[model samples]
Target: MSEAARHELPDLAAMAAFGARLAERLKVGDVIALEGGLGAGKTTLARGIIAALGYTSEVPSPTFTIIETYDAPPVRLPIVHADFYRLNDPAEVEEIGLDDYREGAAMIAEWPDHAGGFSHEAACLSILLETAKTGRIAIARGGGDWLGRMP
Candidate 1:
């Protein structure tokens, strides 16, 4: 895709809008790997997607729990929200049955580096957040089929 056609989300609200838009296009077995620095609003974006799906409960960060499962109505599959920040090795991912989560569910993973090569061939979505004097800049990069649905 051309640079001019790329999506740019200026702030948290815009990011949320982007997330909501993405939610509309999601399907079971889809994987979204989120990459960003600390305090980059990764959880905020996840919250938007979850809330857009009609979930009313608090969407907590999976930083400690490693993963949180959400069951939103009207969808046949559950949404798995995972944070691999605390993982020290890729093998730890297997202990959690990450492969099982890969099937029949939509995954939103933060700090995905800990998952190592698991995201390979999966629709990889990268959200990079940069801070500026005026506000924050959010850039999205995706490969595979996500390129057409993003934004």
Candidate 2:
């Protein structure tokens, strides 16, 4: 386990900027696990990442659909955005062909604990969001190329 570093984002724009920075460092097969309370901006951050990746369409929360796939232009690989808040068990993930999404995809999972454990030697980047007096606090943990660019 690695210690998380805290970042202060005074506003939504700052948070989105942080997300953009994170997107710049991501590659296929990367996994971002988000840990945050309701309305802590998990989806907001993800939206920023998708937009930064050149997705022009609206990026909606995957709460109902469970997962949304976006194809990376030119690269041809996919980005899997998942929300497992409604999951009853980790095993339920298998039913959705979650494993199939892992190959050549950057996965952003909100409520990743529902997946039990990451099967591959996936680069795990955990993001924890909290409410601070001035703004929101974004905490990141993990050792990877993208980790360094977080804060």
Clash counts per candidate, in order, are 0, 0
Runs of candidate 2 with Cα error greater than 4 angstroms are 1-3, 74-77, 117-122, 143-151
Q: Write the per-residue lDDT of candidate 1 for residues 47-148, one digit (tens) a residue.
A: 888877767778899989999888756433578989999999988998999878767778888888878843455465656665555545666666565766
Identify the candidate with maximal lDDT. 2
**Number of the predicted model whose TM-score against the real structure is largest:** 2
Total clashing pairs in model 1:
0
- lDDT digits (tens) for residues 1-151 of candidate 2: 3567788988989988988877887878778788788888888888888887778778989999999989868223478999998899999998999989878898889988877744234387888888888768988886454445544
C-alpha positional error of residue 99 in candidate 2 after TM-score superposition, expressed in Å: 0.9
lDDT of 1: 0.73
What is candidate 2's TM-score against the reference? 0.88
Give per-residue lDDT, candidate 2, residue 35.
Answer: 78
- Model 1 off-target regions past 4 Å? 1-7, 74-77, 117-119
**Cα shift from native, residue 145, model 1 (Å):** 1.9
